[model samples]
Target: MEDRKLTVRSVERALDILLCFTRNDDLGLTEIAVQIGLHKSTVHRLLSTLEERGFVIRDAATEKYRLGMKIWELSTHLSRSDDPAILLLPAMERVRDHLGETVSLYLREGKERLRIQAVQSNQAIRRVAQVGARLPLYVGASSKVLVAFASTEEQEALLNDPEWPSWIDRVSYMEQLYEIRECGYAMSFEEREPGAAAISVPIANCHGVVTAALSVSGPVNRLSIDTLYEYAPYLMEAAHDMGLMIQ
Candidate 1:
């Protein structure tokens, strides 16, 4: 009976740990402990166990814990769930069909940008994408859009990163972000990867939170800098449609 009671209490505490995370992507040990009214040692032990099982991940730089892809992987298929990745796939396919270029969806994952889904172009020379590919937040057009629309806190965090190029003026980049915010899209040619060009548009939640991005990509010659601008309207339209349905 004592063992049974201990098991019940453990389950309750575990549930409380999971419930401690909602809306926000990350929490530190102190924050979780204070929120759950538990000791720091207990919270650390629980988080350690959860990390071992892939229920959560710790950012090496921030030392904060966020729900892992394992949790996202499980919850994505729940009935009637309106996950943006699921919604973005079909829209991406349409963009590929419209432009005969590759289309992809991205979301900010920590300081890295994650490509969660993509539809490839039919051409032999087109850019190829893997679903789980990650890139730096400040580099590509899709990632730039995500950063531009991010909260001021997040933007500041990324801009202050030590990896920022020395030649690129921070003040100018800040101003450019404002332009991206005003125009509702971002474009790039040979910025991240040589011989590649991309055009991207933002996806905002019902709360006007800019959370994800949709982009079309192709070879630089076929989809030159000028062509990227021409494709912006189509990307914006698809992103706008998806934004309307994001709960």
Candidate 2:
């Protein structure tokens, strides 16, 4: 009974401390203790242990604590889950051949999306995103489709958070999301990078839940909006085929 009580309290306190960081911009031990109703000495001990484990770090100048790199390391590992990638590659290859554009696969890691695999087009010019790059889910066509299709609670949870650094205009993201749902694919023209364009379709499993997105991208000169629009049908078809394989 004593051990059970300690375990419950320990979990409650740890969750409280993590939640406390969301309320303030940056927090010191005293601030955390006051907010979480823990003693300052206890807060200090927990913070030091978290820091040693690389889950939190101290600011040199301000002496405040914030999230640490260990989170990113873990995120990278989780983003590259192999089963989806293996199933998606053949369809990506088919779409690459049909559109003659660079094709990519993306999956969500927390609130961010990571590019897990890509195949470059054999064109004279190409636009490239590295395999392991992380991008905000609120931006870019592919990421937005993934976000838009998520449960309303999950969507609001991300949008309502006060800690998001790069603020995406909420209205525009909503508009783009509507378009993605209507068209069964997402399209963007150099929104993230000027002079480039992208078209993406979300791939779903047998249950019709989106598991990943496949996108094709290239430079404006070669990949005009008209060309992208023409490719959208093919992109959706490829995604459907890939989803069947993955499911």
Best by TM-score: 1
- Compared with the true structure, what per-residue lDDT tens digits does model 1 show for residues 77-135? 68555777776677777788889999888989878888878899999899998777778
As for candidate 2, its clashing pairs are none
Candidate 2 lDDT over residue span 1-247, tens digit each: 9999987987778768776654355788788899989898888888887789887889989999887788668766764344777667776788788788899999877888888889888887788767867787766778878887778888878887775544577777678777778888887788888988888889888778888888889888877778888888878887888887665
- Top candidate when judged by lDDT against the true structure: 1
Model 2, runs deviating above 4 Å: 1-82, 165-167
Tell me the lDDT of candidate 1.
Answer: 0.84
Give lDDT: candidate 2, residue 76: 69
The all-Cα superposition gives candidate 1 an RMSD in Å to the true structure of: 8.8
